[model samples]
Target: MKAGVFYGTNFRIGQSSGGLPIIDNDDIPIALVQGNRDGVANPANAQETYAGIQDPPKAFITIPGANHYGITNEDNLIREPNRPTLEQDVAIETIARWSALFLRGTALKDKGAFDYVFNSGDALDPNVSVESVTKPIPEYTSVVSLLGLGVIGASSLLTNMQKLVKKST
Candidate 1:
């Protein structure tokens, strides 16, 4: 499960002779974090890039009331003035938490994290607006996997039974 994280990314910057490089890559799972109030990097560019992805799990998270420099410690208004309702600390914390969850879901294959990121939990968060595309869980491709799960379950049951027997004795 190869995965990637991008924060405040400008998809429009590419040095290719053809101008902007293709944003679509179906092989790697990716999480892109953006600020809805960003004045520097246009949110439209991120939206376009996210739309181009055809397959593989992907998440686009827009931090509400955050600006382009929200990922940073402070926004230097001289570089890019922004109107951000979210404080820097709050924005940073939100980005960190979501990014970690995204990595755990995709890279570590953690079901709880995956569920929150790609399923219903993120929708309830007031700080973010999430758009996600999920690859279906691959079918069990081999009998070994089924057998392995069965064995683990049996072992757990046996251990619990032994503990109960000891307590009764």
Candidate 2:
């Protein structure tokens, strides 16, 4: 599971200082689901990112008591007791439901799904726990993982290059 981040609001594809690309289709909505319990992707990060977008398809969703990867299932989550508790299943359901609404504009069939997703709780609640919910993923693993990634990245690049060569030929 990879967490992708594009820091700073100014996303420029061209030479000019363009703010952001206009969304042509509403179906391909841009959204961000931030975990209030996560310090890494904090409320500030969400606010800044939301501010950067030129036009928003939907309001950013803030899941109460979720960590950085709150969108994923409970098995993938690490627990921190001091924080506002979130059920693992609820976290998964919330993300799944929220994503469905944004990317497909399709609402979750479950009765309370839409209402649950729309409940954007307090982003800057000072009372929430600041203790680390999860440890550093790479740090816990062997350095060999880094080498494995390099190999994978290189192979991926090569595969793409081969595809481009075939297309040109």
Residue pairs whose backbone atoms clash in candidate 2: none
How well is each residue in 44-72 modelled by candidate 2, as lDDT tens digits?
Answer: 55555555544323446566676655555
Model 2 poorest 10 in a row by lDDT: 127-136
What candidate 2 gets wrong by more than 4 Å, as runs, is 1-28, 75-84, 106-169
Relative to the true structure, how large is the alpha-carbon lDDT of every model? 0.82, 0.47
- Return the TM-score for candidate 1, rounded to 2 decimals: 0.73
Kindly list the per-residue Cα lDDT of model 1 for residues 1-169, writing each as its tens digit: 4788887775564422343446566578888899988777778777777776666698999998888888888887886677789989999999999999999998899999999999875667889889998976657766678888999999999999999999999
Alpha-carbon error at 111 in model 1, in Å?
0.4
What's the residue-level lDDT of 101 in candidate 1?
94
TM-score of each: 0.73, 0.42
